[model samples]
Target: MTTWMHPEIGDWEARGRRVAASGPTLGDVDVFVVDAPARTSEELEPLVVVHGFPTSSFDFAHLVDQLSDRRRVVLVDLPGFGLSDKPDAPYRVAGSADAVASVCDQLGLRRFALLSHDMGDTVVGELLARQLDGDWDVDVTRRVVTNGSIYIEMAHLTDGQLMLLSMPDERAARGPGPELLAASLVATLAPAHADVDMSAHAELQCHLGGDRLLPRIIRYIEERRADEARFTGAIEAHPSDLHVVWGPEDPIAVAAMADRLVAARPDATLTWIEGAGHYPQLEEPRSYLEALRAAIG
Candidate 1:
């Protein structure tokens, strides 16, 4: 295992790519990239992965080996989450998409495929929109959108989320507390997935934001609703190959949201990961990776 990963994470971190270079992304925001040195195959385009809220690039840690087997993998801790800088700013989908682009540029990526989960899926939508606008700044070859509330009207968020959001913004300053933060993170995934350990995830919450940035991070939920049209519209009218691999059992995103995405973009191929949860990539790593291999191909 590489020294970059926590000791608690152990050998799982050794499963695949090692960090080539990791540091602050554009705007001096810290973002780590677990990458393999140099190119393995020129035929394979790099894969840029953007993680959702409340979780960092670590969520995809388990799938890094499979994802990078052929292509170089770039995992980012979106601003306000993970190992990235959590500035007290409104974290919007569009902004995150731009950050992803900046990360690609900083890493010297000219073209890539994208896979995003939860709110991160919306960031993929922003990139789709940018592609639709003919922005040559970042070239995205394919996109795989997974469990997310991209369609606000179509999502079924949890009461825990509502309660957390309802708590005054100051609660983050007072601290959301480990238990509260831990519970909210677990609730989004399938309750049956007891095998999915979240101890590291919970620990990440407290340390990632100095235990006082939840309120600022929670603002992404509002941004999701506000940017619905622009983001979803791009998905509906996507420019490149599109795929939607969803866990029908996800409580928050729900399978219906996947259906809507596929329907809107009839060109999108939908892969169903049965008995999985919101974090399908984590819940069913093998199936998710196979689906991604097909999607990206």
Candidate 2:
């Protein structure tokens, strides 16, 4: 594994000055927490955000700042991804969810609203299951936003993703070089907008480190496939108080997927953001933030 200087990571660390950098154990995993101080009364509940695969809490940098001003915002870098310590164990969705709950407990948050995107949605589903199954006492006040994940069938995953599932070690050998990983991350966006330089962000450099831990990361992803039946079952059993805000042009989680989520949770509201792709939060921050505020309110 090669270590390279990632200015993006540095910038994110600096921006997260309000966030205490430390590892807290959650069910044997040392999970990393990036928190913005509570602007509201401590008596008020906090809003916890979870990022999906291949990305970290850094995904919520902008939203966290906005939300933190009015509410306590907690973002977590799931084990093995970000600055969190990666252990030599299999990573599963249930484990990830439990880890999230553990973080909430350690932080003394009694109840929270959830915001998740991409693979984080899967973890969120598991968290809901834990709540329903009586493993955790956390109350999910509301579900604010979702993005280029959910409805697993809709993932327009690349050949590399499918290949990763098949050959973990070989894929890891490909190396998640900063430039290669940065380019792969950039490809997820629409090409028309020159203003959106996804690569210019420092957080991208930190997450591209997945290239080095590709095998373990692939194992974590493939584990989700096995849990699909269970995850789907859980989603069906305990329907979410969800609000879906998706980019219609998203190649990964299409509008139809958001439709399916709405269909599953009929009470939930789904909105399609026009002319945006996978990363709506990054692609359309203003619109996304507006939709989020409305959803949570």
Candidate 3:
């Protein structure tokens, strides 16, 4: 099937692409899986990656290529984001995880390393809970958590995020449009990196809802608050090894979040990228790649 995919994501040569089922009631969307060049006899576990808010698989365009040479990496454009089907429904974060699971099932993936960033971190937590409960079909051998607003109370939310989370219909109806989203995305990066442009990616993301998806997408913030116990508890009680790589300069997912993660998961490894912002993978790709490699190493 000719599945949906954003042209600007620069993954035209992705190993494979397909539209997979998201959930019982939720619909289907495009899922991309890329295979690294086979190298060693001892192959590592394939990695099932989940992306976070406002953006799509495009957010990991560079990082995906960087890691693809080591092991297979799976990327999906969650519903209502990226080049997937925008069904004008509430874009719940947990639903994104479900979509990833469906994608995994399609690939016959049973045991793989799980890595997530931003809102995707929450999705990973949900998968962790399911794995612990023996409900999921696959095994999450290891997990990686990057910068995210896990502890919402401690996060210093961006004006655009706060704006979207407020006033519901009115804000999304007439709130920050594509321009603001582009600006907000740029602002979330390290100021020192002026050459890192996010407009191309941000513009495509803004097209997901024509300024209407913000209200629907903002439902994730509510989920983070309401499902805190289930998500965080699962994170703390997670059986396999857990790794956290944070961008300390991020105003939203700040140092406090990294600190809190370590406090809860004392055994988890934590790596801090000092000058990077919210999107550390983009702001500091080298450091992000190093930390990520170490996680699955």
Greater lDDT among 1 and 2 belongs to 1
Identify the runs in model 3 with alpha carbons over 4 angstroms from their true place: 1-16, 29-42, 169-177, 208-211
Top candidate on TM-score is: 3
Clash-forming residue pairs, model 2: 8-202, 176-211
Per-residue lDDT, model 3, residue 269, is: 92
TM-score of candidate 1 against the unseen true structure: 0.86
In model 3, the clashing pairs are: none
Per-residue CA lDDT of candidate 2, range 113-170, in tens? Answer: 8888777878887777767888778778877556645556667876656766766443
Tell me how candidate 2 scores on lDDT: 0.66
Q: Stretches of candidate 2 above 4 Å error?
A: 1-8, 14-27, 40-44, 169-171, 193-195, 200-209, 236-240
Which lDDT tens digits does candidate 3 get at residues 192-281?
864677775666566646356767876777888999888878877888898989988887888888889889889999999868988888
Candidates sorted on lDDT, descending: 3, 1, 2
> Which model is ahead, 2 or 3, in terms of TM-score?
3
Query: Alpha carbon lDDT of residue 96, candidate 3?
Result: 75
Query: Best lDDT goes to which candidate?
Result: 3
lDDT by residue for model 1 over 26-130, one digit each (tens)?
A: 244554455543245546888888888777777887777666676788787776665556666555555676677766777798888888888787777777787
